[model samples]
Target: MNKKLVSMFLAGAVFLGTLTGCTQPANEGKQGGQEAVKVGMVTDVGGVNDQSFNQSAWEGLQKGEKDYGIRISYQESNQEADYAPNIEILVDQNTDLIWGVGFKMGKAIEEAAENYPDFKFGIIDYAYEKTPENVVGVVFKEEEASYLVGLIAGKMTQTNRVGFIGGMDVPVIQKFQYGFMAGVKKANPDAIVDVQYANAFNDPARGKAIARQMYQRGADIIFHAAGDTGTGMIEAAREEGKFAIGVDRDQNDLAPENVITSAMKRVDNAIYEVSKRLADGNFPGGTTIVYGLKEGGVDIAPTTSKNVPQEILDFVEAQKQEIIDGKFTVPSTEAELNAMK
Candidate 1:
């Protein structure tokens, strides 16, 4: 076994022992003195602190613990194969609700949900073809948000060449790529956009290599939907004195000077809301919830020193409203994006 997997297993064993007996809340709740809901999460390879959806999902658990009086714990997966073991450990701990924090864990979560029929499970970024009776799939209109940032990249690029780096070739990442590229083209029809896929979300070295190549190719601005890999893009932008856009969260602080903006996907809100439903005895099981710009599930980061012109900011805002009001719809697939042009 790999050292990282072994370490993750040991960590899971320790976490399981720690949470074994005390999975339920100690204090009696105001509602009929019932035990508090026990919520746990299993992270993807990115773990909990990747500063992406995994981190955002953990933050939601934290918020649930703080405000909703739910007991929370988590197990971090070191690789794709670790998803089942991590979730199974949480199940053994008697977690009432378990959240799998990435699309890659969809099958694992589904199997777990079936194996543990009494518990509720949630999976992010994936909607199963046939959701189990005890599962909810949470997804976002990531392309909608990415389109906004693409507009920024389109308007702000000094070299008339922009780029997009994706973590995986999955539809979720493709949404970010296609939407962003469309936005850039919408703003500057003549602009050139270069696209690449790192094929690994956690490989910062690969991300940096691709980002550097794009920068060298005269792409003054780059947008990355590569999770932790995107962090490498930010680093390259800073070193090369260029601009990069972040995804899933406001990552401007990663490189304030270089990160002009971020395409926000409110994974935290989705996690929190779903956890709340479970806690409130309103579990949205066997359902796929789609959150979009109108629901505040997707947006551009409000903070950062992009220093874009007021007109540009206003234009983006207007376009955002247009999207919400059905005046325009952002394409979510490569084929649709190509047809749009």
Candidate 2:
């Protein structure tokens, strides 16, 4: 594809148009209409069923299989130590492309890509300062989506106080928290946001404890960037008759009554697009691909709670458009958020 066509493809305008219609077997990996591609993934400690990014990435590979007849496989990591070995398993499987989900696997993906220089690799939530020739960094502007949802929390908070629960204090999760606080501050300067970290993405008990504490402290709504730990926050919100915001996927179904909405990062689209690129002989390796609001990479979930006013939703949509139009830029760091005031 030419430069203009490639730009349009990345922008999602021509993505579906560029896919091939060949009915080849999924295990073959080739370029120039030569062979089918086999894709594999390694999940983070949250596992593939975390109902978060990991699951989204796996779903994307499955989508590639359904749409383009590409083979797909994945290994679920039980802990941080399992990242490297799990990646090795995929590499040994002779996967045409290997995707490592989460920032925790950045180094592992790098090392694996280096060790197996002939293979292509991709990782989510990580942008390497010095990228490998065979690896692509797939990242998203999560703060933009978080900011949109933050508008809802700021507007709908009955007590003028909201809460944020994070899975860990890492940069990715911090981006979500900081953007959320910025949005709340923008929508309602007087709205106070309480922030806490579970330090573990899978610890639901800890998520519940912090969410409950925030609710007890006059917070009527809570937004969580934690993985499975956020599930506990959902349960807490439902039990306390409060509201909660979800992350990654559209988790409103988890507790439709209490979940106001969710900040969604489209990991599935990113993965599937990369897979298509590789198959189309347009693999984007040795660079970082950033999917932001303009690219439809992130947004608030469609499901809305009855408690949220339609006017508020309309206002959020306006803000989203403003961001895309370059009128507003969401903050992704503590200093940027502080400087905004």
Candidate 3:
């Protein structure tokens, strides 16, 4: 493991107290007399196998299940309307803890938390200044990671033109967009970053169409923050003999030769840690945990060396250290990125 990853574990250690969020229910388990701690996950509209954001959260839950002897399952949301009903189903099951997988389900999670103060709930990609006592929110400085991969795009673009495809115009996706643009401009001021949004998170055909157009228009590299749609973009990269940067998790496995690298979020670790907390009897409710470069919450994926040069890797590491030490900040918004220009 990287030294920075170890720091991330220690960074979140402050919240591990004797008493926290939700208590385990009294339902009996097949193993010992102890009732198994049950964890239920509610995925956003992308479903559980989008090979991206939602999948990362489910990975965390599976790890927790193995390490903590907990019971875990997921409810897939095929559309926006599925959010509340899926959460309601989990609640009816008397699940010890429920996790909502994305920012799109924030409102539903918030309402469920409010309606059932006795039940514990958690969410990713969204935070609250003052949450209810039974809810936990985990957010990440995704821009920091996006910026790292953007540096690679800027340094490697043969045509001096790159592309950014987003799933939606949400703040969470914006962090990826502006951060990527910031790093590109910083590394190669003359480079052009063409940006567009799919307005949907699961449409691969649309993502492929956009990537094809960008590649035809002189972009040799492209980055996508659009969930399953990004999968199509990676496929397009493979077909076009170009490069694509993935988001949320390392997606090189999807197209090892085409995906140069990914802007990764340690979503799996975050979910595992929180699930363990719930099992241990301290759930840290009414709080939001924010992870950044310093916390190992976000980073450029390890596969970067597969395509990026050692010199660029060294530069990105130097920049990573600077961000960790508070010597610099990565822009997370459109206005902040514009200020850089």
Candidate 4:
């Protein structure tokens, strides 16, 4: 007697199942449309607040959040081993972009990029040999910036001797050294340029020791490319009443009296610009971006609150424009330096 009703109920159940299945894709589409874009960063071995490269990259991510309304997060890698895992964490979180900060992370970023082709990645200061389609390499014309600093060091040195302390022996650091030496040679042909490598980013003691050695060797001003190591050099400069140039961020605030000026990297600017492009669906991949003086990617800091002589400050400002306007070209290679001479 109830067969007709039972058959009807079974048909109703089939209809409901079909409707649920059809609604699933639309619901997924709606969720995807409403999802917020997220960006994450993994710092290099120097960690996030090194007052150097890592710090600069993190500053860019912060700016991206503020300007683009994207969610941003970061992980500071205390050791080299942490690079891949930290990037994996961001990928697992479904981050739209993961920035691997510094040359130390090149291998990790390369490996991760291969494993996740759809995930976008960017690294600062270095590039991979075999990078994925979604990866962007962000490098800098560091030599260009360092060359300007070298000019300052050459002219401002009272002892006619200047020094450069690098964090590691990488090509990136060498670019800074070579550029600086070239600049000094151009400005003061008689000036002596001493160079050394700390080999580690976190050792302040080593930085101080190197700076002291350079100072004792008759160098009056030292330019440091070391991360925390540079802090030690700045400290030594302050104690000895000499001058030290800062790097990456505007480190004039660290020791306002001793830091003559910082060779600005504009890492924050790079991060912000990259994230903005990615968020706008104009992601720049498979191309390496090299930012320099004209793009405002690098420059020297303004005279600090300590009041460097107005005359010297004015001269530096004028020189900055000259470099940007193509009037003065900084050399990066030994060959270029010789050519400039």
Candidate 4: pairs in clash: none
TM-score for model 1? 0.91
- What does candidate 4 score on TM? 0.86
- Candidate 4, run of 10 with poorest lDDT: 19-28
Worst 10 residues of 3 by lDDT: 18-27
lDDT of each: 0.85, 0.85, 0.86, 0.79
lDDT of 4 by residue, 23-55 (tens): 001001112366557888887767677888778
Off by over 4 Å in 3: 1-33
Error of 3 at 118 (Å): 1.3
Q: Which tens-of-lDDT digit does each residue in 237-301 have in candidate 3?
A: 99988999998899999888889999999889899998899988999898999989899899998
Could you give the C-alpha RMSD of every candidate to the true structure, in order shown? 4.5, 9.6, 10.3, 11.8
lDDT value, residue 292 of candidate 1: 97
What is the lDDT for 16 in model 1? 63
Better of 1 and 4 by TM-score: 1
Rank ordering of all candidates by lDDT, starting from the highest = 3, 2, 1, 4
The best-first sequence of candidates by TM-score reads: 1, 3, 2, 4
Candidate 2 residue-wise lDDT at 19: 23
Give residue 271's error in model 2 in angstroms: 0.5
Best by TM-score: 1
Better of 1 and 4 by lDDT: 1
Greater-TM-score candidate between 2 and 3: 3
